[model samples]
Target chain A: MSFLRTAPAFRAGLGMRTIHTSRVAAVQASKQVRAIAADETAGFKYTAENAILKGTVNDAVAVPTPNKAHGSYHWAFERLVSAAIIPATVAAAVASPTAHPIMDGVLGVTILIHSHIGFSACIDDYVDERKFGALGTACRWLLRVGTAGALVGIYEFNTNDIGLTELCEKVWKA
Target chain B: MARRFVQTNSISEMEGLKLLNTQRMNRPVSPHLDIYQPQVTWVLSGLHRITGVAVAGVFYVGALTYLLHPIYPAIDSAHLIEAVHNLPVWFKTSAKVAFALPLTFHSFNGIRHLMWDTGKGLTMKGVYASGYAVMAASVISTIYLAFFV
Candidate 1:
């Protein structure tokens, strides 16, 4: 058997002497998907962070592949959307529809995004793919489709109707 | 010779693991949410999310309902206003309170969250102070909006 030269994994060009042992069951790592254990799920294995209480020390850590979009950028985006809601809400409270028709549409979209992100966070926490399987996938897709439909609905309300700001104002008084 | 009163069973590695897993299935999860006494810190945190979901849920449902405008002509804003207007005075006031409470609480608590994001007001003392502050502010704001505004 050849030892890996200064690497955790065997490099592609490294030549290794073949070693066969009946004691150690051997299987190749999957090319398309990675699973921690032989019968484990592709994503995170632990149902909850607190599952460590019952877990073995040998359980593999679920290290996420960091992406710019889903990392710090997502946090920044969420904060930005939240901050944007402040002004949009103010405009909704005080602005006149006839004077600024687009303001209604702006508020609708901003609030929609903020709501979507909040719901998405809940779904991610509770309906994890590793735990909930098909149900989890369904919730995520439903959120997406619902968001799209809501966007269209908001657009229609803003364009054709008395607009959301005026509608809220009227409703509050009503 | 002392009498032995111990018994043991030899198990393969896989069998041992299976036994372990079976036992693990019945392991009680400690420090459950129900056992915790209600306090300002966690209570406010819970309320923040709950109120946020309540307010946002309404927003989403409203926006989604607008999609039905094409099919249901009576489902417009005018009809909604008329429907609410036709309700009794007590019902109207209570409805206003219902809407105002969650809206104000979520809004005020959200600012608290934003302050936290900027790495401010996160101390134990600061957290409590802010929690009380949010509660007061949200209550007053909701009352003002529901009763006066």
Candidate 2:
């Protein structure tokens, strides 16, 4: 009844005063953790750069806090480990961009072996094709087989730096 | 009379055939993984798989290192030496161990491949024997080089 009975001017004045007071209080609260500063929010939500831009005009800025479980020491240890691993990881990348040529040579030998096997397969197919008719399904299969083998042989011939003699030696040794 | 003679021969041959059963003739003689007790060979085989994986992993890391080395020139000799000096003793030791691992694997594996080439260690006995030697050599050389030098 007291609020309702107040004079119109008085009520209007009180209403204005209440609005001002509440706004001031809100402004003050916003200055602390009001999500006003993106940087502050970034500490909580995003990377350092992102948080800085995302905070609200009325928000108070706060940095991210680690989970309660980690405590102080765990964070410190994580940083220490990162410092150690990041460098060596970088160095090893430089020494050999690809497999060492020595390893490649081994692989090359493997290719040569496969090529020879392919060549034999081709010869088998050719012989089979000759024995059978050219149009028959079995003869067609033989032709395809021989062609694959020949192609492999040609590829091996192109890539192989090792001479036939060396190839023989290596294969025998294997 | 002729039928009787034939019958006698057929019966004798059947007896001879029973003596030469297929299972007896075709059965494998050598030890299989199932029959033999596990030994150094098994351990060595496990180690081979592990080392193979490690070698591949080492290569991957090595590749990444090489890629980054150019971008980050800070890893150059003077910087690296400085970094080494700055590192704790434990880290330095770890670096030494890491450095030796690939070298030791390559060396031991090379020798193994060489033995295989000579066709001397293809038998099971020879395989187990050489596997032990390779394992021992790899471990000893790795430790000696890592810790001492």
Candidate 3:
């Protein structure tokens, strides 16, 4: 084992019995150890920083900021509106004969918004703009037009006809 | 070390998509719906999307029918109501119950989803608890809406 350790020194023409050569070998070994430790610490920091910067750059280059923000807020708001509709609907259903126009109007708007968001999300998931560019655009426009017409129809029903909840109740008894 | 850096500026969106597609093609597809065990999370997620479409469809169809009421008097609200009213009692109850069930289930499960969005009820225990809670709420609400309301 010792001969193996000394082989490189002997090949480099450093005599093993010389005190100066041994001291020089010890100094080189310590320097190499220090260099390795320094490299490890530096490598760790570089890798961590590189990972973070790469992630940021990729997001900025690949995804539009508005699209990213669109998803979370849209999802949360849709859920919020749907949650609010529950109590309003139950109350509206129970108070059938006496129609509350305001409550009914609120229900109409919330349902429109909720359904529009849901439909839009489905379209976003299923339709790839890169693959079906024109179809995707058309579907989105169709949704907008359909939502507007539905909103108007709902408004008319709530006002001219018996409101939604009442109509459901009436249908139930029918 | 210098050779490790990749120049991404020359890469077009189409090229990137092609690369991704190639990689996807090479990998064995895993966790496919047909092969994977059906779990609560995915089941609920699928149901959420389905219910969303169903509810929107109901609204769209209703609105379209109303718009066409001029041509078809039978589709008018009064006539439609009367038509439903004339149905047998069992049919009426069953139809209303079926209609109410989806609406109530979607509404209750939706609230649970909203809770998840807020980062609550995400643990396994929380998920199961919320799932059972949503089921109970839907049943109770459906019964009330169909019968009492």
| Predicted structure with the largest lDDT when compared to the true one | 1
lDDT of each: 0.80, 0.47, 0.70
Candidate 3 clashing pairs, residues 3+ apart or interchain: A174-B84, A174-B85
Ranking by lDDT: 1, 3, 2
| lDDT (C-alpha) at residue B134 in model 3 | 83
Those runs of model 2 whose alpha carbons end farther than 4 Å from true positions after fitting are A1-174, B1-38, B69-71, B75-77, B98-102
All DockQ scores: 0.29, 0.01, 0.22
Whose TM-score is higher: candidate 2's or candidate 3's?
3
Off by over 4 Å in 1: A1-57, B1-10
Q: How close is candidate 1 to the true structure, as a TM-score?
A: 0.81
Which lDDT tens digits does candidate 3 get at residues A95-162? 54344777877777788888888898888877645335678789999999998888878877777677
Which model, 1 or 2, shows the larger DockQ? 1
Q: How many backbone clashes does candidate 2 have?
A: 29
State residue A158's C-alpha deviation in candidate 3, in Å: 1.9
Candidate 3 chain A has its poorest 10 consecutive residues by lDDT at A48-57
For each candidate, what TM-score against the reference? 0.81, 0.32, 0.67
The candidate, 1 or 3, that scores higher on DockQ is 1
Q: Please identify model 3 stretches exceeding 4 Å from their true place.
A: A1-61, A66-76, A94-99, B1-31, B143-149
User: Candidate 2, residues B31-125: lDDT per residue as tens digits?
Assistant: 54567676776655555545544553443333234334446755333443455567777776676677566546644754575557557688988
lDDT of 3 at A82: 72
